[model samples]
Target: MTDDRPQGTFVLLDLDGTLVASAPGIVASLRHALHTLGRPAPAEATLDWVVGPPLRRSFETLLGEGGDVEAALALYRASYEAEGMFLSVPYPGIEDTLSALSEAGHRLFLCTAKPLPHARRIMAHLGLDAAFEGLYGATFDDRFDDKATLIAHILDERGLSARDGCMVGDREHDVLAARRNGMTALGVTWGYGGAAELAESGATRLCQSTGDLAGDVAALLRSETGTRAPVA
Candidate 1:
C-alpha cells in the first residue's frame, strides 16, 4: 500500500524516564542532597515521582517550607555531575526505535525537564546524541522548566508548526504540554508515567511498548490536524 503519511515529522522526545532509566541516578543524587542537608531522604521505591519533573519543583517538595532548596539543588547537581548522571542507560528497544524513526526521515528533538547541558552529556554518554536534531531543555535559572513553555519555545525556535509535530514521553506533563501547544501527545507505557497517568492526561495515543513507538508516532504526526488526537 502506498503511504500518505507525512515524512520528516518533528518529534519531541523526553529524556529521563522515556528514553533512559534514569531514576536510579536521579534518586541517588536527590538522596545525596537531602543527606548533605541532614534531611532524611525517602526510600528509592517511593521516589519514582522525582524522575521526570523539574528538579526545582521536586526539591521544593523534598525540602518543605523554609528549607534550603538552593543548597539542596547545588548538592544534587554536584552529585549528578560527578557520578549520578553516568548511572543511567537507555531503555531496551529505544535505540532501534530511534534508528527506525530517523531512517524513516522523522526529525527528532530531545525535550526534557533535565537541564540542557546535562541532557546533552547524558545522550552523548549513551551514544544516542547523534539521533537528535536538537536537544532543548530546562536551565538552572528556571527557563523552560514548564513543559508547555518549553514546547512552545521549541516550536518557535525551530520554526515548525504544531500540526507537523508530536510530543512523545511517559508522563502527564508531556501529554498536557503537547495538547496545550496544539500537538499530538504520544505516551509510552514502558516509562515512568505508565498507562494510567498518560490516559488520565488525555494522550492522543499510547504505545504499550517501545516496539510500537515509531509506528504510533508516524501515524499520529501524519493525520493529526493540530488538534488533540482521540485517546487510544
Candidate 2:
C-alpha cells in the first residue's frame, strides 16, 4: 500500500520504557552503584520508576540529601557502560512500528533522558540506529536531565516547530515535555506509565497498543497542516 501522507512530520520518540524494556539493566546498575557507595538499594518493586528519570536523581532519592550522587552515578556508569547497557530488549513489535512510520514518510528522532553516548550504544545494540534521523539526549554531566530541555534542543537544532511534530512516550515527563514545547503528545500504554498517568499529564492521545500507535501517528501526520503554538 502506498502511503500518501506528507513527509517532514517530526516524531520524537522517548527511549527506555517507550522503546525498550531497560529497567532490568538500569535497576541492576543502580543497585551496583549503591552497593559500591555503601548504601542500601531500594526494593526491586520500586525500581521500575528509576528507568525514565535521570540516574543521579534516582540515586539522590534513594540515598537522601547527603548522598554522594556523583559517586553513585559514576559507579553506575562504569557497570552500565560495560554490561548493563546491552541488557535491554526492544518492546515486541517496536521495530515493525518504527519501520511502518518511516515508510509512511515521518521523520523520526530519538529524544531521551539517557545520555547521548549511552542512548547511541543502546540503539546500536538493539539495531535501532538506522530508525532515527538524530538522537538528542542529556549530557554525561546531567546538564539536560529534563525532557523539556531535550525536546527544546531537538526542535531548535532541527529547525522544527512544535506544530509540525509530536512526542511519543510512556511517561508523564514526555507528555509534560511536549506540552511545554507546544507539541502534540501521544502516550503509549505498553510502557512503564499507566493510562492514568498519561491522562493526567494531558496526553493528546493514548495509544492502547503498538498496532494502535502506527495508525494514530499516521493520521496525525497526514492531518497536521502548518505551524502554530500550542494552546494554553
Candidate 3:
C-alpha cells in the first residue's frame, strides 16, 4: 500500500541510525559504561549495529543478567548526558531529504526508541528537532517498551491518519511495529539493518540509499493509494 503523493503524506522517521548518524556517541557511552560494569563492550562494529535499537536490549545482551540494568542505563547516561551525545553526525543528505519532504507538504514525525530527554537532545543538537512536525520517543516516564505501542501513541496524539503514515527506519523493530499498527515499513539499507532481516520483518519497501529514498518518495508525494518503494 504505497502512496505516491506529494501532499497528505505523513512520514515517520526513526531518529538514530535512520535519519541521524548516531553511532559514535552511542558507542562511546556504551563502551564507558561496560568497562565500569566489569563487562567488555561489544566490538565496534557490533556497537555501531546496535545504535538503532533500544538501550535496555543492548545492555541485556552486552552486560548479562548479572549486570544491573538500571545502573548500566545510569552509567551510559552519564557520558551520554555530558558529552558523548554530540559525538555523532548526521549522514549527508538527510537534511536535504527532510527539507524536500517539508516543501512537498508532507507531515514529518520522528519515531524512536531513544529515551525522551536523550532523543530530544540529539534532535536539538543536530538541528533536526525543527524538521519534524512532532517527535515520539520511548521513555521510562511513559513506560513505553515497544515500537508498535509508541507509534500508535504518536498517531493518536498527533491526530495522524494511519493509512497516510509510513515508517522509514533501519531495523526489524521498526518494520514489525508498522505491521502491527497496520502501516507501511520502508527499510533503509544505508543504515544498520541488513536486507534479509528487514524483508523478513515485513518491510514493504527497502531503499538502497538516502538519495534513492528521496526519489522513490517523490512519486509518493502525489499518490493516495501509495506506490511500492524501490528495494534495490
Candidate 4:
C-alpha cells in the first residue's frame, strides 16, 4: 500500500497556551501548592505567566530566595496530577485546525515545557494524541525544561534540520528556542503570551486567530521550504 500524503514541514507545537488553554488547571495547581506551603500566591492578573514557563522557575519567583521551591513543586505536582491536569480544553477550532494541518501533510509534534508523562496523559485524555507524530517535553528532573535544550535535542534525535522546522508556540521561550536553533518561529496570539511578547521575542510570524492558523502555518512553512520540494 503506497501512502500518498505529501511530506509536510516539521511543525513543533507548544502544548499549553498554544494547542490547549491549560491555564485554569496550571494556575489552580500552583495556587493549591502555595496555599499548602502557606505562601502567598500571585494576584489573578499575573497568574497567567506561570502557564508557559517551567513550574520550578515560577515557584522560585513566587516563593522568593529562601523559599522551598522543591517542596512547592512537589505540592504542585500532587495537586495537578490529582485533578488539575484535566481542567483544560482545546482552544476553539483547534481540533479542526490540527486535522487541516495534518491533512495538508504537515508533520506535527508536540514540543512543550510540560513533563512528558503528564503531557502524554493529557493528550490521551483530550483525545488529541492521534494528531501528533511525537511528543517532546521535559522530564520529571527538569533536565529538558528549558525549551531551547529540548528543541535542540528534538532536532538531533529526529535527524531534522533547524532549517526544515517551524516552532509554533505562544511564549517567548518558544520563540527564543526556535531562534537559538535557527528554526522559524510562529506565535499564536490566542495564547497566554499575547502579541507583544511574541513580537518582542522575534517571532517570524504571529497568528491572530485559530481560524487563520492553518493558512498562516502553511505560508510560513512554504516560505521556509521554498524551491525545495516536499520530502517523500
What are the clashing pairs of model 1?
Answer: none
TM-score of 2: 0.93
Instruction: Give the per-residue Cα lDDT of candidate 4 at 88.
Output: 84
| Model 1 ranges off by over 4 Å | 1-5, 224-232
Model 3 C-alpha lDDT per residue in residues 135-154, reported as the tens digit of each score: 78888654665888898898
Q: What is the Å distance of residue 227 in model 1 from its true position? A: 3.2
Order of quality (TM-score):
1, 2, 4, 3
lDDT of each: 0.89, 0.86, 0.79, 0.88
List CA RMSD, all candidates: 2.6, 2.4, 4.4, 4.3
* Residue 69 lDDT in candidate 3: 81
Candidate 2 Cα deviation (angstroms), residue 151: 1.0
Model 3's alpha-carbon lDDT is 0.79
What's the lDDT for residue 57 in model 3?
87
Question: Candidate 3: where is the Cα deviation over 4 Å?
Answer: 1-7, 218-232
Q: In candidate 1, what are the lDDT values of residues 99-121, reduced to their tens digit?
A: 98888788999999899999999
Give the Å error, residue 83, model 1: 0.5
122 Cα displacement, candidate 3 (Å)? 1.4
Worst 10 residues of 1 by lDDT: 223-232
When 2 and 3 are scored with lDDT, the better candidate is 2
By lDDT rank, best first, the candidates go 1, 4, 2, 3
Best prediction by lDDT: 1
